[model samples]
Target: MFETLSALFFAHVLADYVFQTAKMVQTKDRFGSMALHTITVYLCAVVALGSIAWQIAVLAGLHLAIDALKVLWVKTRDDDGIKPYLADQVAHFITIAAIAAVAPTLWADGIWTKDLAQGGLLDISAWAPKMMLLTAGAIYTTRAGGFAVGKLMTPFAAGAPTESLPKGGMMIGILERGLIFLMFLAGQPAGIGFLIAAKSVLRFDAASKNEKAEYVIIGTLASFSWAIAIAIFTLAINNGLNDAPLLEIMAAKD
Candidate 1:
């Protein structure tokens, strides 16, 4: 069951995040152009459910349905805020879980088979499959996290600078979260402290007014909070994927 869920989850991430580009996202929302992107999602589901003809259709159909609902909702309300994105992802993943629970047989014969496991993928570890998931999570945390921060920090935005660097906040959020991700993967949480200290030292400005100071403080705290939360989540999920529960891993020193 875990294997099936992991496989389909990775496929969903690939379809929604990696394969679907910015242009694809914009074009997909239009009523008539939904088919191509939907097919791409189906293709991803097929890759995950290879040779399981019935399951392929099942997952693909469900995926298309969820996506269509999202697109339609976006079109009708004309609100492309973070709410829609969150709703869209939550709906799709929930559907995937429900379908997989009800029809585990659909994924039983796919990628997790012993024959395939020992053949071309003999050298691969469970971590290999998990890497795909972590990569997708990292991407989502950066973009989605930034949008979330922007939304939450709206009233506080008035005191903030119009611009700090070129593509500044977005790029910084991505890099900061990416670094935090690496720190978690490497099991060095102390690195995060150093990162924070470095940022504080650099952005130290005594002459800056109180409002901008408060703005920077809030934004930095928000960014770091998001990064830390995601780092912990990525580590926890990857541990599960590797079949090492967090408690057991924490207990091990040998």
Candidate 2:
């Protein structure tokens, strides 16, 4: 069940974050754009689930239904704020979990079983699950996490710098969260202190206004907290994939 959930969750994140483009998001109400996005979801499932099966169809079809409903709700309410965004994501996650609960054995006779299951570097089947979880972690910590933080920080945006470089803040958040994710993966949480200190020094501005400083502090804390939580969850899932208890894995790492 965990395996299935991890794979489907990864596919969903990949489809929604990485494969999905800004134009696709903007035009999601259109059938062509929605269908293209659903296709991407289907293909991502094919890769993550390691098979072409009916389960994948169910996953994609339900995803399309959820997205269609979200679009309809947004149009009816004439609002595309964070409420609908978070709700839509929650719906998709519930759908993924449902499918995972009943998903069949995807790796038993999957695409990777024939040519690559022998072992070693070519044994994709052996590593694909962990890879999926790790990739999902990376995407969530950067792209998805950025989107979430941006939405949550909307109210506080009034005090943010108006003269900043184009997408500079977004880029900085991505890099910061990515570095945090890697640090957790490497079991070096201590390094995050240095990262925070370095950023503080670099962004030490006129020291006259505190609004921008407060906003920056809030955003950084949110980003770091989200990255850390996701990183721990990813590592826990990876440990489970390896058939090891979380405590045992941590102990071994130590």
Cα lDDT listed for each candidate: 0.66, 0.80
Give the Cα error of residue 163 in candidate 2, in Å: 4.6
lDDT of 1 by residue, 122-151 (tens): 333334446555665677567657776776
The candidate that achieves the highest TM-score relative to the unseen native structure = 2
Question: Which stretches of model 1 miss by more than 4 angstroms?
Answer: 49-53, 75-78, 103-108, 111-127, 143-160, 206-208, 246-254
Model 2 lDDT tens row, 24-124: 99999999999999999999988776678888898899999989998998999986766777788889988887887676466544665446444312346
> Which 10 residues in a row give candidate 1 its minimum summed lDDT?
245-254
Off by over 4 Å in 2: 116-123, 206-208, 246-254
TM-score quality measure for candidate 1: 0.75
Task: State which candidate has the highest lDDT.
Answer: 2
